[model samples]
Target: MTNVTPRSDIVLDVQDAVKHYALRRRGLRAPRRSVHAVDGVSIRLHSGQTLGIVGESGCGKSTFGRLITGLETPTSGTIRVGAHGVPIAAAHGTGTVQAVFQDPASALDPRMTVRESIAEALGKVAGRERERRVDEALAAVGLTPEFGVRYPHELSGGQQQRVCIARAIVDRPDLILLDEAVSSLDASLQAQILHLLERLQQDTGTAYVFISHDLRAVRQVSHSVAVMYLGQVVEQAPAEAFDRGLLHPYAVALRSTEPRILDEGTEHVERIVLTGEPPSAVSPPAGCRFAPRCPIAEDHCRSVAPDLVEATSGHLVRCHKPGELTLSGVARADAEV
Candidate 1:
């Protein structure tokens, strides 16, 4: 059986995080609208482990990443990292964590050479030591030292991403938030980056919060997986549980689109395709955000908001009928607690 033990050494804890953005008209009779970017999202990442977050575009994946890294503060709830056991609130001005954005080109300074870009992040270290750290970080991401002097424009998309990854690691942060870190890279390059990430985690033991829209990439790197819809976490479980069967409707639908991991001689399961656009986060539909699109959505889903309950060991989901929906040979492995 897969290791389902919740690692005792959790590096980051996000407890009921809620973030909302208020929209206001320019002047006069303007009513304010609040965009509910992250609504009651909770996650836990262990030291030296990768937690993959997956969702469609505008599903608050990026926003949740920002909240964890303290780039954007949560309107409610708290985020704590490595200090104690409690879920402490993440506040501004803390550099204990780092981030790598989606756009490799935009992330790097056009004028600064790769070495300089990485050095800037390690500015605290002076003289020859800082330069050596830059070299080490670049090498960690499989980039040659000679590539350091080149500007962002001179590097290929993959190379630029390597530089970005190097920049994030130069500081040797306890946690790194990678938002679509490898999405822009080619498939082969993406594999290289993913491999590098695994090695880096083993070497430095840094916790990772990896956010992506691709299930395949998430499956490759994550020890745990979280599925988001609208602004809430619909399903989260150990990677092994996801491999067995996803409990939430949204996760099952998303997984149906993922490439099958079977090596050979396995029956191919049909995909569970979902229809319709997600409801507005500002005024999300009653009950579940997925009800409007869920193939098995019922009256309970349309009327009452389902609480996030544990349906199995190391797995939590928000749905009225947690494991009632099945696909192919998949079955619910646990009951709601």
Candidate 2:
């Protein structure tokens, strides 16, 4: 049985989470298969910290976000919220989970005013107090009360996202799933939203699962970063791992693409570039899912899978030859995390 013991500071705990969606049979005799959206993924997030999940499109990062938010149930494994490790039934509940999705235009209701939208998220608050809380949330997101009377169409893109943020925080949830929350906004607006998220975290101590394809944005907000590929984590480490060093080849290639990670006017000594897109999740190849695209792939990597092994303190990588590459990191491990 899973431990599920209570941990005071742990805000969210996930163990071997697997979410698969079965596909319809092509014919009566066709073998059944499922899309392996999120396979054997596990991570822990503490209060007031952000875990940034970065990966290319169709890599299942969004699906993982859905699992954490309870929007979709995992096909297997456990997701326990609140005081970490506490069994869901035997635990005290402070595990309010909320989500701020990518597009604010479609996310907000066309009919409801800003205050009304925020008040709805407050659930059962009285009229007067709901109004107060709504106003407060607006203020927290740097909006004025005058905007509250306006409809979704009346607000600009940035303002609409601010309303979305207000809705997520109006009830003061313990965990917020920010799934590409700022991706739709322009660079200036994205900076504003990112800063706003940080300020709100300081004020409310809300833990965040910030899922994005934008590695640059992820680095700005994450305490730790996890890179996913074809429904599995290729590497997990502290955000400093970007500069301090990354182990997995996939992670290295992803990092090299980010110009900001390199110093201004200085060429990176170990820039890795990989070709081709990720294979389909429905029928990913055997062994490491990243092996086909990995520049350092060997016969062993193609035929045999590698476990996510701990390399340094709190840094885990899934690769057959994690240490042999020019990626820049020492890799030695005896056990899995």
Candidate 3:
């Protein structure tokens, strides 16, 4: 779906967002430590688009999602929703921005029927209008009004997720944060849900922040992708980065893990095995966060930090050398690092 909205009409704008939670102390005079879940992350989303966030667990993609959806307030920075400057960190209600989490079973109340679950999200849309919207949303998610009478337990896994999607869209939100939305489902069901989301976006012009570990799903649904490392976004680029290869070492490492159905003349990229666990976010490395594990890292990489700069049109990468580091298509074992 092509969104021709004015350039000024940015649906979601997050600038230098940070979220840090203090660890519980064991002693009265113990050292104070905080986990930096999301650190200085900035992103802008347009209408009728999808920004897929991919990273390992605890990389702060979910925390970032919570910040934008207003589930949790930021420790610093601003998150604005809509061109009207309506702040999202504190004000995006269920109607303005919604979330479809991984576990559809836990998200829905077994006590409430499908209709009630969808209706609760309707907010102030009262009487006949409320009923109409619920039914319309059910239809949009490939569920009939008859299915609304059933409880969450009565429906299949895919059916329950469909109901959750219905609840999120019933209010017609400007943005939806789907945190591993379809990862819990079977592959076939995941494909169905992804297709449904795409259709819904096309029909309603709703923007989405799809967070998942599944690179295949992210690549399938995202107009653009942002790779988060530790607590910071290391690279951000258009969907073409998946095929054209990424600049940041961490981004390339993540991309290399996924198998590609190569076309004729396409090069086969070997999966780069990353050594060691990610450094603690409480005390991230002084220079590049990925330097300790970077196979191609040099002394300079370990000494200096790189700013997230525009490597090309709409592509931002945080790397001192950028493409100068022989990565992408080349193997680290053979490359002149």
Clash counts for the predictions, in order? 0, 0, 0
| Residue lDDT tens for model 2, 37-140 | 99999999999999999999989999999887777878998887664454333332333778899999999889999988888888777978888899899999
Worst 10 residues of 1 by lDDT: 85-94
All candidates in order of TM-score, best leading: 3, 2, 1
Off by over 4 Å in 1: 1-8, 25-31, 84-94, 259-268, 331-337
lDDT for residue 287 in candidate 2, whole number 0-100 = 87
Query: Which number leads on lDDT?
Result: 3
RMSD of 1: 5.4
TM-score of each: 0.89, 0.90, 0.91
| lDDT preference between candidates 1 and 2, better one | 2
Error of 2 at 163 (Å): 0.4
Alpha-carbon RMSD of each model: 5.4, 4.8, 4.4
Off by over 4 Å in 3: 1-7, 259-269, 324-337
lDDT (C-alpha, whole model) for all candidates: 0.85, 0.85, 0.87
Q: By descending lDDT, how would the candidates be arranged? A: 3, 2, 1
Task: List where candidate 2 sits over 4 angstroms from the true fold.
Answer: 1-7, 84-95, 259-264, 267-270, 327-337
Instruction: Flag clash pairs in model 2.
Output: none
lDDT of 3 by residue, 199-253 (tens): 9999999999999988889989999999898888988999975557578878777
Tens digit of per-residue lDDT, candidate 1, span 18-91: 99998776667767778899999978777899999999998999999988877787899988865344333432
lDDT of 3 at 228: 91
